[model samples]
Target: MKILLYFEGQNIIGKSGIGRALSHQKRALASMGIDYTLDPKATDYDLLHINTYGPKSLQMVKRAKKLGKKVVFHAHSTEEDFRNSFIGSNQLAPLVKKWLVALYQEADHLITPTPYSKKLLRSYGLTQPISAISNGIDLKKYYPDEKKEAAFRKYFHLSETQKVVICVGLFFERKGILDFVEIAKKMPEYTFIWFGDVPMLSIPAAVRRVVKKDHPKNVIFPGYINGDLIEGAYSGADLFFFPSYEETEGIVVLEALASQQQVLLRDIPVYDGWLNDRMNCYMGNDNQEFEQLIRQLVEHQLPNLSMAGFKTAQEKSITQIGAELKAVYQEVLERPYDHQIYAKVTK
Candidate 1:
């Protein structure tokens, strides 16, 4: 079947989950042995998968609907991001919400990365078929051996004996940067690393200077990092702490799992079916729980890990996840998706 994948924005090459999701979609399409094109005007395709409902994406979605084409929104984030970043906090949010509701009402299917996200969207009165197709992992890029602990230590001028923790995302409140700051203060023994861009958002010069000035010796904020470096960071790190309050699903957690690094996330319900305490993840509520979990992880007294459990979790390999996505596209195109899908292959 022919399909058109629409991205509302330009490439976010090496930063966030949208890039990861886009990569998965492309890989899934290729795995299906399907002839897919991007931004094609005159193509015969089975479906058109719009990535978002932004201004650009909305136009594409409307046109696809006009052509009587089946469509899916690989909606990986909350409508809040679009309402805030794309439309600003002005009258635009309400306007966009109306348009999105209309677009969603007209959509043949809505694809969500997490069940929690689906439940949340349902609260928004989006009464449509919602499928839980994750923005899955590429195990080849992430593995237990890929984390270069020694290299990371040397590059960051950190001691091999020192503990390392990583938090990947921009300096957004929803990403829980301040929560990380509090965690950094409590854990002076471990070297905390923030591997994401700060310049993307508008921060006051005074706040920037203050963040730099108050940065503890244990904390380091390296700007944007590429894949090799990111793999190395994940490989060498002892833990991944992402306390996001408003993420659809943090794909970074999957990357961390692939590296066999223990995950510590805020107690977000959508993470329930995926993360297991001490097994694939550690869930936290307040700073105390976060601190306690970190201490336990350091002590190695929680979800006991064997090579077997680690391997099983990491088995959500690139080919495996990509195949599932391809099947979702096929199923959505053929008819409305009602059955659960966690074990589908590309073929």
Candidate 2:
């Protein structure tokens, strides 16, 4: 069956994780030779795969239902991760959860990036069948690139011998930006670089203060980057340090693992199944532990787990994800659409 793959507000959230996930979906579909269209208004598709939960997305869901088509809602955002992000996000989180519940309940099937997220959605009391699929990684784009690595060092004026730790995320409290800065302050020998940005108007004051003024000399905010620069950062950095407190599934973590970089992460539930502490990656509960681990890693006292991490990445390749999506689509298409169930939930 033909599928309608749609992501609302591509121009606005195009650089966000949800946006990147949509791109990965498109690539996966293309690699599998699956027939799909990005147009939400297209009437020729049998199933609609939507990634965003905006008003336009709801409208599209209604249209798809009227056309007797199945809808697969991708749960990329949750109230837990929505809190502590942006200025009024905490205050708005409860309302956001209610909205998510209503929107998600309308779906024929739901897809989330990880099992952790699927559990979260179930707790929200959604009745739809949920599948946990990885956002997957493009190993070709993220693998060790020697030329790009050298250029990254030269562009940042970083010496080849100098130790560098890198993180890629928006300047959000939930992303552990403050903790990253605090760890950077504790280590003067290693340069810490954060490679993403959010509009200053949308950021919380505490995060804004640290990003704009309160950070240490060792810390650098190069802002949002992609293509060669981001790939280079993954390859060139001594460590890929991600201290995010919450996530559906961290695409950056996958990229880092695919690049064969040693990774350090916060001890969060989202990584429970795939990531093993001190195995494929290292996990810390607090800033102090993260600092200690960083020091140990730099001193080469810690074991190199990059190869093991790469193996994990290999399992989540685009081809595998494509196959999984095809199976899910076929299963959904084979099932009868339950109009009575939809009406009961909405009522």
Q: Which prediction has the highest TM-score against the true structure?
A: 2
Off by over 4 Å in 2: 341-347
Residues 1-347 of candidate 1 have per-residue lDDT tens digits of 78898776554433567876777778866766767878547557778887766666766665666666777777666656433232133346666657667666556678888788888678779876888777777777776553465666678886666788898876665677777878889889888898876554354443354356666778888877866677888877777788887677777777777777777888866677766655656778888888888888766777634343356446566576667667777777778432222111111
lDDT, model 1, position 171:
64
Q: Find the 10 residues in a row with the least total lDDT in model 1.
A: 338-347
Per-residue alpha-carbon lDDT of candidate 2 for residues 1-347, written as tens digits (9 for 90 to 100): 78899898887788888888888999999889999998767999999999998998888888888777888998999999999988999999999999999888888899999999999999999978899999999999998999999989988999979999999998899999999999898899999999989898898888999999999999999888899988999988999999999999999999999999999999999998999998899999999899999999877898999999999999999999999998899999999879774564443
Clashing pairs in 1: 147-235, 323-346
Q: What lDDT does the true structure give each of the candidates?
A: 0.70, 0.91
Counted clashes in each candidate structure: 2, 0
Q: What is the lDDT of residue 271 in candidate 1?
A: 72
